[model samples]
Target: MPELPEVEITRLGLMPLINHKVSQVVIRNSSLRWPVNLALNSILKDMPLVGLQRRGKYIFASFPIGTLIIHLGMSGRLCIASKKSAVQKHDHVDIIFNGPENKILRYRDPRRFGSITWTEDDPYQHKLIMSLGPEPLDNEFSADYLYEKLRNKSVCIKNAIMNSHVVVGVGNIYASESLFQARVQPHRPAHKISKDEIKSIVDAIKDVIENAINKGGSTLNDFFDVDGKSGYFQNEHHVYARKGMPCYLCDHPILQITLGQRSSFYCKNCQK
Candidate 1:
């Protein structure tokens, strides 16, 4: 699944090419998506893309009349291709802009879990986004706020951060990396963590997320940029997927365990 950094990069890459350009929307398939693509034909064609933005992992393309919300599920990607190019398998949505330059943007999702939704107003109010917590890079998410949110929570630290209500876009890979950086054990109960440890975790989360974004996000299996290039962040990972490997900080053998049914990797000697 694409995380916040990958989504942010997509939004930035899309803003310049999409905004102010009139797009000819084409939906080859909508039966697999939720909220359907019925109203897309009415509002998308001939409408200038007012803005490109992101909320959590969902990408939003704003128009005068409505907005297009895109979710890249487990195996999904948004690519920019020639308007005249032929459609490939899993190319479900295409928005072609016939203006000063002919540019085409396509959405490909092998899992079909991705979605395309149209909303008349703010897409943030969509049921999928309404309950999501603040973006980890935003001012709304801070050490103090995270400490408050984690107070008295008995759930494991791994599951707490995975909760959308607690934070957004801290996926399994990020969660493991952040906890390792903070020296907090992933299996530690949230309530048992001290305020200082919570603060460290919060700071580690932000730092790790920002670094990942700068590195173009971690490519777990099928994620790619708008140009279909692979991201290199996975190569720089410190704890994630490094089970039995030596810890970079202490030379201790990195350990891995199942937490919340997800693989959690850390140095037992380094992380408390």
Candidate 2:
């Protein structure tokens, strides 16, 4: 699935469409994770795209009529294509913009797990967005807030951090990488972690997320930028997916365990 970093990168890549008016919306396949809103063409016709923003893993394309909420579930890719570009298989939706360039914001998903929805009210108050925790890179996700949230939870730190209510966008890969960076074992009970350790975890989360965004997000599977570029952050991973590889800091082999039914990797010696 495309995580927060990848979503943010997609938002950035779509910035050029900010002031473009929607000429039409073409839905080749409406059967996604959620049905693509069939009225999108009429609702968005001639509406200017005022802004594009991301909350957690969802993208909000703001317009005068409403906000277009997009979730790049699992294998979804949102790319910029010209109006003349050939529609290939899996090219499920197209938001065509009115301009000399006639650019099309194309959404392609092989798994059909992505969604496109619309809302006329405040997007933040949307059912999907209302319950999400603070963005990992936002000031609202401070160490103090995290410590308070986790101080009473007995859930394993890995699962706790991955909770959308506790903190959004800390997916499986990022959870493993961030925990390894903070030297916190994924199996540690969240309530037993010290305040100092919580601080380290917060910093590590921010650093790891920001670095992933800078690198265009990890492309371990189907993730890619708008230009179809693969992320490079996987090259710098210390523990994630390095199951039996020797730890860089210590020669001990990195271990892999299943937490919350997801693969987790850590250096036994380096990540106490």
Name the candidate that leads on lDDT: 2
Candidate 1's residue-wise lDDT over 163-263, tens digit each?
87889989999999999999998999998898899889889999999988876633422343344553335657889999999999999989999988899
The candidate that wins on TM-score is 2
lDDT of each: 0.80, 0.88
Q: How far is candidate 2 from the true structure (C-alpha RMSD, Å)?
A: 2.6
Candidate 2 residue runs with Cα over 4 Å from true position:
217-227, 230-233
Instruction: List RMSD in Å for every model shown.
Output: 2.8, 2.6
